[model samples]
Target: MRHLPVLFSAALMMASTATAAPHVVASVVPIHSIVAAVMGDKGSPELLLKGSMSEHRAVFTPDQIATLGTADLVFIVGHGLEAKLAQISGSEAVNGKTFIQLSDAPGIIKLPVREGGAWEPDDDEPAPAAGSEAEGVLAFDPHIWLDPENAKAMAREVAVDLGKADPENAAAYAANALAFAAETDKTSAAIAAELAPDKGKPFIVFHDAYHYFEKRFGLTGVGSISDVSAQAPSAERLGQVRDKIIAARATCVFREPQFDDKFVQAVIEGTGAREGVLDPLGAGLTPGPKAYDQLIGNLAESLKGCLGG
Candidate 1:
């Protein structure tokens, strides 16, 4: 009888220790980086997508879904960024868990999907596509983490959620988020100063993914070769982008390593535009809290190298 009581006590202790920390899972690398910062030494969240894959077309395995089922809190950019996550969002696995969509976070600057016409005004009102206003559906860009300000806001949201999930470590999460936000501001200032000379300088990107970054740093994006869908622009659309590039006298055309280079090369062909690479997702970076800084820095360096910065 004495030994039985000791065994029961040991089992209870193990169970308590196992559930001491909340298990967190983030949808993508950039989001994971921010959440990791908030969690800090308290805990680490699992990254759903581990590499340079496209989040738009990412396929989740059964094991990953199972991991989501086990998470105490889940974070995603939402707005169809991780299409596969829709399945798990409503599943029983996430029934009692907290889910955060960074796109809906406060102070998030949303840019509309650029249709055939020129850059339109930024408004909460949704406008239709160029000609098919009635039939065309309104879309908002989901690449919210490209801007440091948005990232800071997202970090705050994450810290708030983490504090709720694990109240014992609430102060740590808040402190880490504050520290991260300050660092993000510092990095943003440094990047802006470095690229200030080239502010308003025109450039072309692989896709319509850098509007947040461009709008933040005062850079001008002439046009993107691809749309947000990652679909190749139609021949007429490509010609229109080419005309814009030529008209703006864009000095560089940027391509992402995740996508094929042939299209970018063909677009810039005969235009005398220098080719540069811009990786918004930080494909080559090690996924962690520090990777966000590296991603922003790399983007600035890439722009400077190609745009005479």
Candidate 2:
């Protein structure tokens, strides 16, 4: 009976070890949605930033930093999107923690940072060559998750890393990734069809954050009111954008949920351009397996709504 108790205890411990989920952390809501989808029912990944927090301006609490230090894996958009976490995760404080930069994921297309507010054709600066620095600043557009294809690529990476970390749930993760990819494809096609009528219509965004989404759908973005940093445009800059809005016959001026709309109003004031709201972060939507689809869908609806048929 003594031996049976010992054997039972050993079996219980082994079972617990075998079934425990990996401690994974995701930086932003969109990334969290993808990770959650890939993890499926096997495990849940912890989300770092929540509810419309801009990745560029994200400020982490001390408890969040501690969470990073103890996580088995951390997924982030590396190219300076979550600058604070990126800097902290590299230090010895989180030594031995596996931090996966989905920006570096193979097959994800990265666009260069647009040089000026009005992103004229001449303002398209090429992305910095690999392994070479660009004036010690963020070089590529860090909003890779805006593109469904890019999201698919991120999901594959999350699956691979999660599978490696939790061997017991490897097959489940792989299957979920495949399923998520299919869903993204269907979602992309639907969005493309929804945005077809709005193609070639001139529009202005609050910032140049939607290049990936614009490029993916062949949408016409005449210019942005703010820089990549999302700062409010100066009066001179607003005047310039207002002129462009008139010249381009822009259909709408789109403001982001995370930014102040006063600048957008200033740009469109007396320009006869309607104002619309777009959220790239899925901030208004609940984070979960279907959040990415909802995010992309909402953006399309917003664009089509303002641009008109």
Candidate 3:
């Protein structure tokens, strides 16, 4: 009879522990997608930035800040991508949370910020005077999730870290990660095939943000309308871009929905070049586990639609 009471108590404790999953928070939609994949049905992570807002310009609400303060784990791309969120996450109130910056993950391939309408070697750009976001003009590209290979690496790291944070669900995390990696491989191959016809086809982007995606699928972005610092190009710089487009015979210039389209239209005006919209953040798409693949597929389709015959 005494043993029955002890058994009931043990069962109740186990149930309580099982339901107590870690509170996870992600800085952006793409990162949140990967984390959600790993988490599966275990739990859902809070996405800090929900829409087309650029991470560089994100300002958290008081509720969002409070959410970060209470998070058990927070995933971010790092390398100054989410400077504001990084600051908040590093505050003393959030000191207890485990922040996983995927940029520092093993096997992550870093590409330098392309400057002056060409791929600048990483060694060529001047170093940031300090780690401040204002001085991050020469920082390595932060859109790591654009490349499926890098996404796979990040998923592994996320699984490992999530395992560490919640050991009871360790095996589930590993299984989900493996599944995500396989899906990434399959989706990447499909995207590559879809984009194969457009390989080496030159294009222009609103900003120099798609280099990782371009580099991944053998596409060539000859120039970006915006500079590495996201500054509006000078009149002289705009002239240079127009000349570069004419020189490269680029058929299409891509604009991002998050940014103003006036510059894009002005650049392509009378040049006979078509304009296409590329949403790097998956702006209007529903945010969830499926968004990552959808985002990549959308890019490929957008490129093909504009550049392909």
Candidate 4:
């Protein structure tokens, strides 16, 4: 009877004490990066689809789902940006908890899909896509976090969400948000100047992932070449791309870090345009650099090396 009383008291004390910090499972490294800045040692946070894994086609393993049970928040790049995330999250990944969609965040600027098969509206007129943006089905560019300024905004939003989840640490979350935003601004400015009058230059990306970057820095992405997230284009489609390259005289065609480079090699042949890979997922694959500040520097340096070389 005496031992039972002690055990009951221990259980009561345990129940009275506060729980551990909530865990966050991020769908993209950039999201994880920003959140990590705010979380510091406060939360258990990890990147899920990591590295070159296409967010659009990320496979949700049973082990990954098990980890999700521990997470209080799951942050995803929205608007179908995370290929099958909505489905997996709703059905399995979220573990019955709600997740935040970055695409839904305030200050997110969505791009319109041009009818002429371009990734954006004309430089002169920026209009939302037909039918979709009108109905508010897809209002914002899902890749807003790609731009450092916008990423700062996103960081604030995430901080607010985190604060709501842990009111006790609300002050820390806000402070971290402000600090990270300042850092992002500095990083972005450095990158913008490093491009050195090449913002107006033309280049082709294997995917349309960099539209937010182009919009932020006044760069022009000439065209997109592949659907690394989905099916590879057919040979005929590639022939058409070659024709477009000839017509545009683009500087170079960009590939992605995780994709097979065979098609890119074949297409760039005889065109004088070189091959380079843009890493969107960050060091989720390699652990090169994890923070947004370093990420921006890495991107700028990569661009300088690939384009200026």
The deviation in Å at residue 155 for candidate 1 is: 0.7
Candidate with the greatest TM-score versus the true structure: 3
RMSD of 4: 8.6
Estimate candidate 2's RMSD in Å.
7.9
TM-scores of the models, in the given order?
A: 0.85, 0.87, 0.88, 0.83
Distance (Å) between predicted and true CA of 283, model 2? 0.8
Candidate structures ordered by lDDT, highest first? 2, 3, 1, 4
Predictions in order: lDDT: 0.76, 0.79, 0.77, 0.65
Put down candidate 1 lDDT per residue, 167-191, tens digits, no spaces. Answer: 7778888999999999998999999
Q: What is the lDDT, from 0 to 100, of the residue 34 in candidate 2?
A: 96
For residues 30-140, write the lDDT of model 2, one tens digit per residue: 899999999999878898998878876777888888788777678887766776665565565665354677887878888887765476322233333354322223568
Write model 3 residue lDDT over 170-257, tens digit each, in one string: 9999999999999888889999999998998888888777878999999989988775445555666666778878889988999988
For model 2 the local lDDT of residue 175 reads: 93
> Which parts of model 1 have CA positions greater than 4 angstroms off?
1-19, 92-98, 118-137
Off by over 4 Å in 3: 1-16, 93-98, 118-131, 134-137
Check candidate 4 and list the clashing pairs.
Answer: 51-285, 56-83, 110-140, 110-141
Error of 1 at 220 (Å): 0.6
Which residues of candidate 4, in runs, are more than 4 Å off? Answer: 1-19, 92-94, 114-140, 227-231, 284-290
In terms of lDDT, which candidate is stronger, 1 or 4?
1
Worst 10 residues of 1 by lDDT: 1-10
Better of 1 and 2 by TM-score: 2
